[model samples]
Target: MSLWVDKYRPRSLDQLSFHPSITQNLKALASTGDFPHLLVYGPTGSGKKTRIYATLHELFGPSVEKLKIDVKTFTTSSNRKLEFNVLSSPYHLEITPSDMGNNDRVVIQDLLKDVASTEQVDFTNGAGNGSGGHGGPTRHRFKVVIINEADSLSRDAQAALRRTMEKYSSNIRLIMISNTTSNIIPPIKSRTLLVRIPAPSSAEVASVLAHISKKESVKFTDSNTEPFFEAVANNCECNLRKSLLCFETIAMQTAQINVSNDSTSIIKLDWEVIIENLAKSIAGNRTVANLAKARVVFYELLSHCIPPRVILKKLLFCLISEVKPSMATELVSIAATFDERLSLGQKSIFHLEGFTAKVMVALEK
Candidate 1:
């Protein structure tokens, strides 16, 4: 079965739940037939992409949803070749050039030129008739290029984008989606209209959860359901996508359990539980043997695709609750050090293990 997040996602601007003001503004803009380049950004799971797709559907109709994936190869100025997979429809193209890392500039410039150079086919007139009194020429005025995770784009690539945005303004509209606009250069920011989508509030998230449960015929009347969803929403940190997934996971796990007892255990993601346990183990024990064991758990989390930074942050929070006030200050300092180091180097495991070792040493002294 399809995930509830996708299954219940709003297909149009009017269907959006939170940020009604933003949706209304978008609806008004969509009706105008012509609008400036858009920069839609927000925290994860906050519906930036959903709104982008909805806007596209509003602008180009259902044809925009008939997308196909294409893998294209481009050669960099340094003589290196890079291949990127892009999702494209008749009206627009979507790509995450950040996947190419520093070479993203090459991909951005080449791809933009390739798409903008080609004039849109005018099919407004009846086919085979060059000119007609009844049917003239209808043409797509412009195409959209949506770049996702744009904040991950290197500074150099973003600079290249600024020029391309100006050069292709007539034929292409660029919609950049990112977690924040801070990383976006001023020139590009000046060129596009910015739209920020905030994460849903706890009540809004709970309401959406309720709607999903009712639609799926899940038993919401169970005593465990209310607190369970509230806990999920809070634990998800206002991330609607994570909240929904957590809800589904817990529902499946406790499908057969008695409702009264189920409320006693607030469901946490398996990785979260693992991180919590790891934190307790480190705080409680300070020895080489325990450190070694902790490393194993860290690797296990990494294997599950839990980012090293996320693991470190969760570990820090868990440690804060378990340690003394003075120890908490020391631990935060150590975490910040490692976090900075982690960003400067590619050896995430080394930094992660080093942080654990430091914590152990601190506790021992």
Candidate 2:
């Protein structure tokens, strides 16, 4: 069975919820034959990608949904071959150049040029010239290229992107998706229209959870279901994707445990539980030995595929709640320092360990 998030995902702009005005604006943009390059920025699980796909569907119909994954190899100026996987359809392609790390500039310039060089056929005439062709009135003039995690792209890659955007405007429309726009260069930002999607509110997330629950026929006692979902939403920190997964997990566990008998049993995600434990450990005793133990926990979290930045943020939140009011500001400052270092430096483990050690020292004072 498919996950509820994918199964219930809105197929078109009209089906989207939680931001009616944004959906309407996207529909309007899609209806037109010509639109500028778009920069969609938002927090995680804020529906930026959902809206992008919906707009593509509106532009090219259901054919956009027939996607296939391909591993493409590109050679840099130094003749280094870099291979990465991309998702593509007949009308558009999706790539995450950040996956290429420092060599992202090579992928950006080469991939964009390769895709943009092919000019599309004109179907404005509604009929081919004395031949059977795939032309019938409605057709787009250009293809779309979606680049995810654009904020993580290096400076050289962003510069390469700016040139590509200008050089290929006639044959391709670029859509850049990132968590923030501050990292995007001014030239690229100036050329593209920005669309900001905020995280959904708790009520909106709960409503989506309710819809999924009703559709899946998950039995929840009427008295406890609403508050349980609310707790899930709040715990997920307004991330719709995380909230949905949490709900599904709880639903499955509720079924296994006999929902009627264990109405108050709250199911916590394994990662959250681990982070909470680490928080308690850090708050309990500020010692050199405890700092070493925290290092082991940091590696444990890393083993589970949690990003270092996320781990740091969650630990900060937990510490804030457990410590005295005076320590909250100092902890936040420390987190911000390490967060910047984490972004600029290549060694994530060092920064993560450093942050934990610093937190312990701050607590002692």
What's the CA error at residue 88 for candidate 1, in Å? 1.3
Residue 233 miss distance in model 1 (angstroms): 1.7
Task: Please write out the lDDT profile of model 1 over residues 98-188, one tens digit for every residue.
Answer: 7776788888989998998776665653233211122224335678899998876777888989988878778888999988786687888
TM-score of each: 0.81, 0.88
Which one is best on TM-score?
Answer: 2
Going through the candidates in order, what is the number of backbone clashes in each? 1, 0
- Report each candidate's C-alpha RMSD, comma-separated, in the order given: 4.9, 3.9
Candidate that would win on lDDT:
2
lDDT of 1 at 293: 91
Residue 254 displacement (Å), model 1 = 4.9
